[model samples]
Target chain A: EAGVAQSPRYKIIEKRQSVAFWCNPISGHATLYWYQQILGQGPKLLIQFQNNGVVDDSQLPKDRFSAERLKGVDSTLKIQPAKLEDSAVYLCASSLNFHGYTFGSGTRLTVV
Target chain B: ELKVEQNPLFLSMQEGKNYTIYCNYSTTSDRLYWYRQDPGKSLESLFVLLSNGAVKQEGRLMASLDTKARLSTLHITAAVHDLSATYFCAVDDSGAGSYQLTFGKGTKLSVIP
Candidate 1:
């Protein structure tokens, strides 16, 4: 089975600039998640979507970060006015259920 | 809020030695997941443990869960250099309405030859 796919494997942006990352989940996957992982730290949930509708986004930095999954398929995460602290790897994962999460390779963002 | 804690934070062992990493969580959950991540790579699922006393082994790595104690252990037997990577334990928080996972800080393993 094809795994979740993410692109732009790497990106560099200046502070206060805007950037977007794309994610294409596996076929038939119903749940998608976005996570932020900093250097030497665990992945932190940024948002979650269940078939094009948001399920949870309590931890998202709404002022600068926003995510959406349209048509219940591919999803996109955008960061506006990026900050230096936003430098980290953004991972996208998809799942059919709670137990089978398949993750993408992630996009490494370096904000200077 | 569900909190997951992994002990030792970092572990360095010599090849052919054995060691165990621990994970403790603060809430009740129906499943636990173990994932391995190599440097600059995505997370790879290792095991999914459900229910009390569930144990699963693959190759030289074994994982056990104790739901009654809210704990899980990943034991490495005769560790090899290939097994040197960061390991994370995530607990499923069903009450969170979406089966969201609460992940531990991760245990970084380094196996020396």
Candidate 2:
């Protein structure tokens, strides 16, 4: 089976600039998640979508980070006015139901 | 809030040796997962333990879960250089009314020749 697909493999942006990352989940997976992994740390959940409708996003910084999974297939995460601390790897994952998550290669963002 | 902790944040072991990584969570959850990640790469699922006392093994790695104690473990048997990677244990919090994973800081493993 094809793995989750992510774009831009890498990105560099200046502080206060805007950037977006895209992800295409595995075929037929109903749940998609976005996680932020800082250097030498675990991946933290940023947002979750269950077939287009948001399931959880309590950890997302609404003021700067926003994500949407339109049509319940592909997802896009955008960070506006990016901060230096926002420089991290953004990972996208999908599950058939609630388990067996498969993660994408991730987008490495370097905020200058 | 849920917290997951892994011991020995970093581990350096000689090849042909054995070691175990521990993961402890602050809350109750029956689902535990282990994932391996190489530098500059995505995570690869290694194991999924669903119930207390569940144990699963693949290749040179084995994982066990004890939900009663809110703990999980990944054991490396006869470690090899190819096993060098970051290992993470994540707990499913759906039982807590949220469908998300709470991950541990991860253990950076380096296998020395």
Candidate 3:
């Protein structure tokens, strides 16, 4: 059983630039989630998907952030016109149903 | 709104000592999860306490939940350097449908030999 996989362990971009993060969840997992973890803080849920459909994204910044899980197996989170406040670690996690969440290594974005 | 808080944000103790971290939530939840994360690393699942009075133990660590009190505790027995890391407690609010977790700020533990 492979763990959740994420791409681009680290990223650096200028303010107002666009950035995207990719996540490939573990096989057979039915739920996937994206979280933003600022330094010295807990991870905050950005979006959640059950299969190909979104379950919740109320906390997502509609004006700048968007996420999609097209085939239910992989997902992507994008931030357009990124801001300095958007510099944080983006973590992807997969679960059978909210019990044990297998997390990816995360993409650390640094916006200057 | 759901809020989770952990006590003693930082803990430093000698190896072989016993200590416990506490977690308190604002609302009712179906389950609570404990995770350990090393600096610059992803989180690792530690324990899941489901239902009131649920308890689980592994190695030198034990986790328990009290739904009525809306609290959870992670107890470390005879701690070791290997257990040094940031521990987080997350709650899954019932009826939220999201199954999204509300996490505490986390307790950073440092065990010295």
Every model's DockQ: 0.84, 0.89, 0.84
Indicate the worst ten consecutive residues by lDDT in candidate 3 chain B.
B93-102
For candidate 1, lDDT tens digit of each residue in B5-77?
9988999999999999999999888699999999999999999998899999999999999988999999999
Worst 10-residue stretch by lDDT in candidate 2 chain B? B93-102
TM-score attained by chain A of model 3: 0.98
Worst 10 residues of 1 chain B by lDDT: B93-102
lDDT of each: 0.94, 0.94, 0.93
- Clashing residue pairs in candidate 3 are none
Which one wins on TM-score? 1
Name the weakest run of 10 consecutive residues (lDDT summed) in model 3 chain A: A94-103
How should the candidates be ordered by TM-score, best one leading?
1, 2, 3
Write the residue-wise lDDT of candidate 3 on A1-111 in tens digits: 989999999999999999999999999998999999999888999999999999889899999999999988999999999999999999999989677788899999999
Tens-digit lDDT track of model 3 for B4-60: 999989999999999999999999885999999999999999988888999999999
